[model samples]
Target: MAGQQVYLDHNATGPMHPEVVAAVLPYIQGGFGNPSAPYAIGQENHRAVDRAREQVAGLVGATAGDVVFTGGGTEANNLAISGAFLGRSEPMRRHLVLSAIEHPSVRETCAWLEAVHGAEVTVVGVGCDGRVRLDELAAALRPDTLLVTVMHANNETGVLQPVAEIGQLLRDRGVRFHVDGVQAAGRIPVDVAAIGCQSYSLSAHKFGGLKGTGALILRDPSGVMPILQGGHQERGWRAGTENVPGIVSMGAAADVARRDLSANMAHGLALRVIFDNLSARIPQCWRNGHAGLRLPNTTSLCCYHADAMSVVLALSSVGISVGTGSACASHSQEPSHVLLAMGLDEQAAFCTIRISTGPENTVEEARWAADQIAQAVERVRLVTAPEDIGGCGEDCPCFAHSSR
Candidate 1:
């Protein structure tokens, strides 16, 4: 934050929380022991793992027995969807269901299953408002539908899905439910028991914890299988050497997030308001997500004729950290899949850029970021698509194709 460069890309990956760093330091320095060993040091490591499990469970209104740790949200998601299908009996339903706005982990896995494992998958579409409609899913459901994996919130938009209704409908239908709570678990409260979902996925880094640590929370199902084949770990639900330090950091991060959630939410909301007001000052700027119903710290904005890649570079050059839709989509020339799913044309999606705030960012930084963005957009618009420049005089496309 030395210059004008302040990171506003919390959704992509957050700076590790201080509490999380404190929690993992001992493990990194000297507490390096295998939790599976019988020695005292091993016991200390195992105890740390247990404590982290309890903390994670407590944060999400779950019991310690319900949590199974994994490498990250992607692993948690794969294990939840693929493992559930594999755990079921032969003649298990052949098809799967999920929302179109789901993260790549969910969507792409389903695609793999269909292509390789003989599972048929259907994606329920979202409305322009960015929320999945329950009726569409209900219509897609069949006796052969083995599972439904819907994200609890859209990562790009931060719009919460109608989980309660989804739960109610799936009740007693023989179809399992898995919610991707990665983007929502710490940013918002999620009660798996309340939602009646069989499985929920979450990652620590999305909520200020270290990367490479995620959890798959499962209800007391009659059976669930491990996707990975390895030595006894994660109750045989996932097998590998435990990520002890990362788990400890995740637990500490969860503790802090739970205790300070209200305050964080309020602060983020205030900062978002300021960002929104600033965005409104520029002509032709449009917010990508549901304006009022979104994560407190995120804003994905679209400006006419503005290429997201160029806007990100221009901002970075001036010391404002942000993300174009580019990195999120693997630097592809394509627009946002989330935006397209919500009915935006490719043009609007391509023009989108996201700014997400976090605990470390200050209101002052948010203000400066907004001003920088407004100015950057005016310049980016001229370079990327001169035909779309309406508010300001046009002349600079030098940074239009720069790396984000």
Candidate 2:
């Protein structure tokens, strides 16, 4: 077991960047003042928030006014979905469409709306390649469809969705579109206008900022209602006192991500290539998702006849951190819904693990991590009996539907 620790789960969350930490130090130390206060210190903090807004907007090709800071990505998603549906004047437009592979934040929010608010929800399926089926999405639309929400990039498989095409399709149909850009914002070049989404969601933690801060970029704030009602903060779009230090940290992280976008992407691509080549040597170990149309930093590997959780534990024992699926649903015993939506059987879904690199990772680390993963999978397969190594227990819902 290596003494040194390697973190390859950037999709779940990442350590704060040094620049981000530096940017927030003053606010945390003594620069604390309520942005709403009518004093000099308050005005200063207010301006800081405005500057942070502009910085985040610059990275996503949005205006400062379009950025509304929220508690996190999940809150941003809730605001986008629930706000849009609840804010509309016409109750007839109650139909909502979503991609089957969206993060739990998006999926669960939509489900809540259907259950509690009488909204009609339609989930469009994905192909074996892990990309959403555009034709199926089009077929699922209706005259009463209020919105279509899809992720810009998938968290589990790292597959890039056809957001531009979907945007155009929804535009032609006169329907609103929302993009969950949580995993895409800092990793890829994003232009909300170019993508034609009415709203977009991103979490700062995914890109090296603090976990409690995120933002929603709204093309027109008037189109959605405020989910949190109170004093006029965030231009009355979001309520409650501003998180000064966290927002400032997000701004600094955004600036660093924008400046090093090209170089960081190249570095990640190099590391992915190295890791993929090395891991391919393992028997029956195949990479999931579209090879050419996925995030450069993410790799989803499925090892046949190996329990994914066992592999995760083995890797952890060796001072390596990875994920079986979304960290949000880490406690769930079910197999990955994203993989199942992409046509993987329950057994295959249970055998998958996700490895997402970050700016701090290096080519040498990628190679070593892949070697460790291969050894871990081998050990897991050797210990578990063949019949006992398959999908979840019979009590699991997926077990009933599984062909295995």
Per-candidate TM-score against the hidden true structure = 0.93, 0.96
Give the per-residue lDDT digits (tens) of candidate 2, residues 218-243.
Answer: 88665579999887999898899999
The true-versus-predicted C-alpha distance at residue 17 of model 2, in Å, is: 0.9
Q: List the residue pairs that clash in candidate 1.
A: 4-319, 5-319
Tally clashing residue pairs in candidate 1: 2
| Top candidate, metric TM-score | 2
Instruction: Return the TM-score for candidate 1, rounded to 2 decimals.
Output: 0.93
- lDDT value, candidate 1, whole model: 0.84
lDDT (0 to 1) per candidate: 0.84, 0.90
RMSD of 2: 3.7
